[model samples]
Target: MFAVDTSPRSRTRQYSTSSSSSTRSMAQRDSMDIDSAALLDIQRALDIARNTEGDLDHSVEKYLEEQLTGVWNRLESRPNTYVLSKDEFAIFNYFVGRYQDSKVAEKAIARFWSSYQDTGSS
Candidate 1:
């Protein structure tokens, strides 16, 4: 006679296996590389910013435009990862609102580098 196995442990084991597989697939998708089209868009934005020449306000606007594009690109590259946390976004927005000149842009860039170093080291 044929018999069927109906154990609780077997059902639990099957569920766990399926859950783990799904998690792995999600992780793989999250870590996928940046798309080429996105990279090209970023490069084009950077090129526009780099080629622009004018007074301080013009330069800062250009630089900020490029920086914003970069942040967006990074976010796109890792859809599951945030390029800037809430706090970082607040700080960046405040800086952008308050500093619309070339000198401010320079200071902001310096601050960005310092913050990058701090985060990178830890």
Candidate 2:
């Protein structure tokens, strides 16, 4: 038999296994959604990379510049905006490491990534 407490502070409680499982499932779903969005963003960057055929460094520079421009505009409008998620940033870093010969571009992207992290935003 189960008992219910009507007091202001009841310490004992029973939780259903199904309820806990559902909560876990919901959290997993949220994580997967974020991952899926990040993947789509990375794919868009890859398509941009494929379209431009030239020196890899130049191509990466152009791609990063465009992304930075878009992020900058969004930031101008919304001061608290997070430009990209951690996953998306990781993929961007991978591309930057692969074809970035210019230190300036590297520093700019790194600075942006750091600020994004500092914002403690989603």
Candidates' C-alpha lDDT: 0.38, 0.42
- Candidate 2 lands at a TM-score of 0.27
Question: In terms of TM-score, how similar is model 1 to the real structure?
Answer: 0.27
Q: What is the C-alpha RMSD of each candidate to the true structure, in Å?
A: 21.9, 19.6
Worst 10 residues of 1 by lDDT: 9-18
lDDT of candidate 1? 0.38
Residue-wise lDDT of candidate 2 within 13-105, one digit each (tens)?
A: 221111223433332333233432232233444443455344332333454555545444433454343344443344456556543775444
Encode model 1's per-residue lDDT on 4-110: one tens digit a residue.
22324211100001122342333222222223222222233333334434322233344445556544444445434333533334335534644466454444445
The top-ranked prediction according to lDDT is 2
What is the RMSD of candidate 1? 21.9
Q: Output the worst ten-in-a-row residue range by lDDT, candidate 2.
A: 10-19
Model 2 Cα shift for residue 53 (angstroms):
20
